[model samples]
Target: MLDFAKGPILAIQEFFILAGQAVRNVFRRPHYGADIALQMDTIGFGSLPIVILTGFFSGAVMALQMSRALAQYGQVGRTGTVVSITLVRELGPVLTALMVAGRNASGMASEIGSMKVTEQIDAMRALGTDPIQKLVTPRMIATAVVLPLLTIIADFTGMFGGFIVAYYLLNLTPAQYWHTVWTALEWNDVSQGLLKPFVFSFAISLVGCYYGLQTTGGTQGVGRATTQAVVVASVLVFVLTFFITKIFVGNVVS
Candidate 1:
């Protein structure tokens, strides 16, 4: 029992420590501009289409289900309002984070794990490059920057999807749907909507790098790290989502 318990406890400690180091490196000297640019392209541009598709479908389905529930109260026209709020405040950021975690986190772990298993990481250290600075910091910075942008795009796409459903299936005029969505959200809502993604971005990349760096047992270990990164990052997105919501919304604990 103690061994089982200690495993997760140690892992958690290592994760936070790694995250702290990465955070400090982000603002420090010897910044790897080229690597950061490449990672931004790899993480942000590469993940765009899937994030858009996920957002669109999520909003459409939200509209479908919410319409039925609100219809009983004769408030089906408010679908846009609810969909916009839900997407911007929760679904957009959370789902985008999940998708990125599934796609990019696994890739991060696999790539780094492969290097670790093959001793390439040791070669970097031999040449006096800090492995953490060269390998991990760039990824951490790229994901933190990219995920928020993706979340913002997802929020807009989701709102657009909701707009389409409202315009056609629900027979709402385009003007009415647009108006409701815009009016229902304020600057406070937008700020809160964005905060979750920023936090999630850090969690996903840090967890991926943490697991990747710890890889062992050769090829099989790389595979295991990849899978574990995805699972852990994805779970963290949801867990962080709740606490973030509670903190920003400020009524959950009360």
Candidate 2:
């Protein structure tokens, strides 16, 4: 029997070592410019197109669904509010994080795995370079800092998407939709959603970098690590999303 129990145990062990190494790397290497570039690339540039597409589609669908559900109650006007609020508070960050997990996290893992397999990582150590500080730290900081910004962009774009669907496709008056949105949303929901992405960013970066560092064998092992990194990072993000939502609902936004 393939022991699924072993998976979580091994993953937990790897997480601690990776996290400690990442912290030490931050103090030792201090590659400010590289970190900035990585942040820009991972959080901004790579995430932009996917975020836009997902935001638009999700907003449109949410509006349509809410409108259908509310029609029976003569509350179709609530579509904008529901769509806008949901997008900003949940869908935006969750979807953006998923996309980033698939894109940047997997790619980063693959790159690092290749480096490790090629002995480049070993060479760095031989030449007195700190692997944790030079590589892992910059990536960890980049994703951690950039993910929330991406989520914000996604939130705005998603709201805009709702506006388009409600106003044009559904023939809702612009004032009516805007008014509905303003009344139904609270600041706390937005705040909670935005804060959650930082946690997701940390998970993605840590999982990707850790898996990469642990890569072994040859090209096949690197490939497996990349796949595992993306899969595990995405699952963790969703789990965190659910937990954060629970916390937000129970305490913060209640």
Candidate 3:
């Protein structure tokens, strides 16, 4: 019980400290543009297909369920509005973040953990190179930049999926579905959609980096850190989602 209590507090404290260092390194000297670009491709383009698939299926299923429910009330026309609003305001960001967390977080932990096990990180320090700047900063930067773009892509793809359902399954016209989607979207909703992923990106990257940097006990430890990174990052996506939505949308407690 005491270990459980203190473990989370210590992890939280370390995570924040690592996050602060990453933020500070963002504008510091010796910016790794090449590494950052490579990381962006790895994190962004590499994750696109999964993001697309997740968005498409989520929106499609949402349309199916919502349309059926609304049909019982003779309100099927509201399907587009509901699907679009929910996807843009919540599902798109959350789902995309979760997918990225599952994929990238584990990868980050494993890669850095391998380096740790092999003493590569020590070599960097010995050679006057800062390992955090070379490794953690680029990954964090790339994640921060890419996640919001992926969320935006997921948002539109989900809307497209909803369009397919609204047009065919629900017997709604293309124009009607699109118009509802467009009109129902407020600036705040868009801001929230984009901002949530940005914040989530930070959490995911920092958690991965923190665990990666903490790796010990050889190959088994890498495996443990990889699993821990994914679990913690995924949970943070949900936990942060609630707090972020409350902050932007307001009145969760009230």
Candidate 4:
């Protein structure tokens, strides 16, 4: 049992170690502004289409499904309220983070894992470069900066999607649908939505880097690292969101 528990315990320790070093690099000299910009473009701009598509559709579906339930209570007009609250508070952040994790986390693992097997990372270290500073810190900073922005975009697009459903299917006036959507959002909902993505960004970026840096066995190991990065990053998004929501729930209740 000790042997069985040791591997996971060690892995957790290593992950936190990597996280600390990456964060420390953020404040140190020789800032990789160009690399950080590149990662933002890659992780943020590259992800826009999917994030928008998913956000829009998720809101539309939520509005559609919720309309029926509201209709049962003769409250179909409140579809926008339900759609806005659900999308902003929960669905937008979770889905956007998952989409980013699937795309960038796997990409990070494969890119770094390939560099690892090719000895490029080793060569950097020999040249007096810290791989964590050059590689990990920039990615971490980029994700942290852009994730909240992306969540905000997702929230608006989702509300717009809900508006489309409410306007056409439910025959709600534009003023009515938009009014509910706008008013349904409290500061707490917005804060929770933004905060969840920011927290998930660290998990997604770091998990990928951890798996990539740990990769061995050459090409096959790269593939394994990529898969593990996506799986772990995606899982962490869900897990982190749950805890975040729980905390906010407690605050709201109080």
Candidate 5:
């Protein structure tokens, strides 16, 4: 007489156990440097162009919107600060997480899930190796380590994007713009934003890896896992982002 209402609770319990196992798997190996390096290159280096482009456009749009809104009250100089703050604090990490989730999370999941169904993961397990250790661990370590660094780059590029829009497109004075940034910017704001991405990375990577490890059937499983990995990871990222933002902002939102 199992209660259908309690089925989800069992699932959540299983998920946490897997999560603990995944964490142990990620750290149990002797050397993961190569995998880590590859992940950094893929998530950080390969993602630069898009991060820059999106960041730039976002900044430009923010500046435009803020400018138009502020112009009515003659607060044009404040527009630079507004855009800068928004980009550095909110847009940078959230957008970067979204990008990484889309670009790497799904791919990692599918690659692992595909390996799983193809008996490759099984072969590794049969050979006295932990599949979680061999596969999931590497991705988890890579994502956890690389996310903060990627966020730093994203933040810089995003600010530069705002600068581009502010100066070239909006014709705001460079001196004035820089001054606004200097005066309005705080280390807490920057650090708070950057900090969230590291956690976000873990959520995406772990969920992605978990789904991959659980994948079954065949090519269809891989496809479903890939799609589900992306959706689930992205959703988790946003959910975590909301909480992280609140904590960083010191419950200021509420």
Candidate 6:
């Protein structure tokens, strides 16, 4: 049992140590502004299509599903309320983070893992370069900066998708759907929506980086790291969102 627990405990300890060093490096000198921008473009813009598609379809489906239930209560016109609240409070950030994790987290792991196996990271260290600052910190900053924006875009696109369904299939007026969408959002919903993505971004970036840096066994290890990064990052998104929502729920109850 001790042996069984040792590996996971050590990995978690190393993960936090790497995370701390990367975050501390954020305020240090020799800032990699260019790398940060590049990562932002890669993680943020590269993710837009899937994020948009997921948000749109999820919202449309939510509206479609909920309309029937609402209709049973003669409240079909309030589909926007259900769709908006669900998207903003839960779906938008979680879906976007999961999509990003599948795409970029794996990419980060593979890229960095390849570099590690190739000894490129060692070469950087030999040349007096800090690999964490050059590689990890920039990715972390970029994800942190860009994720909330992606969540916002996802939220709006989702609301728009819901609006389309509500307007056409349900025969809800555009004003009515938009009004409910706009009015359904409370500050708490918006706060959590934005906050969830910001937190998930760290898990995605840092977990990927940590696994990449830990890679061994050459090419096979790179593949393993990539898979682990995506799986862990995706799981963390769901786990983190649940806790964040719980906090908000507790606050609201109080």
Query: For this target, which candidate reaches the highest lDDT against the unseen true structure?
Result: 4
Estimate the overall C-alpha local distance difference test score of candidate 6. Answer: 0.93
Clashing pairs in 6: none
lDDT of each: 0.91, 0.84, 0.92, 0.94, 0.79, 0.93
Better of 1 and 3 by TM-score: 1
Clashes of 1: 0
Residue pairs clashing, model 3: none
lDDT of 6 by residue, 82-200 (tens): 99999998999999999999998999999999999999999999998999999999999999988889888988888889888998899999999988888988999989888899899
Superposed model 2: Cα runs more than 4 Å off? 1-10, 24-29, 252-254
* Local error of candidate 4 at residue 236 (angstroms): 0.7
Q: What is the C-alpha lDDT profile of model 4 across 108-165, one tens digit per residue?
A: 9999999999999999999999999999999999999998888888888998999898
**What TM-score goes with each of the models?**
0.96, 0.92, 0.96, 0.99, 0.91, 0.98
The deviation in Å at residue 51 for candidate 6 is: 1.2
lDDT by residue for model 5 (126-223), tens: 88887776676777888877777777777667667677777886788888887887677788787777788878988888878877888899999999
Write out the backbone clash pairs for model 5. Answer: 26-137
Q: What is the C-alpha RMSD of each candidate to the true structure, in Å?
A: 1.5, 2.3, 1.7, 0.7, 2.2, 0.7
Ranking of models by lDDT: 4, 6, 3, 1, 2, 5
Residue 139, model 1: lDDT of 95
Better of 4 and 6 by lDDT: 4
Give candidate 1's whole-model lDDT. 0.91
Model 2, TM vs. native = 0.92
Comparing 5 and 6 by TM-score, which wins? 6
The residue-by-residue lDDT of candidate 1 on 105-200, one tens digit each, is: 999999999999999999999998988899899998899899999999999999889888888899998888888888999776788788888889
Off by over 4 Å in 1: 251-254
Candidate 5 matches the true fold with a TM-score of 0.91
| Clash pairs, model 2 backbone | 25-132, 25-133
Selected candidate, larger TM-score, 3 vs 4: 4
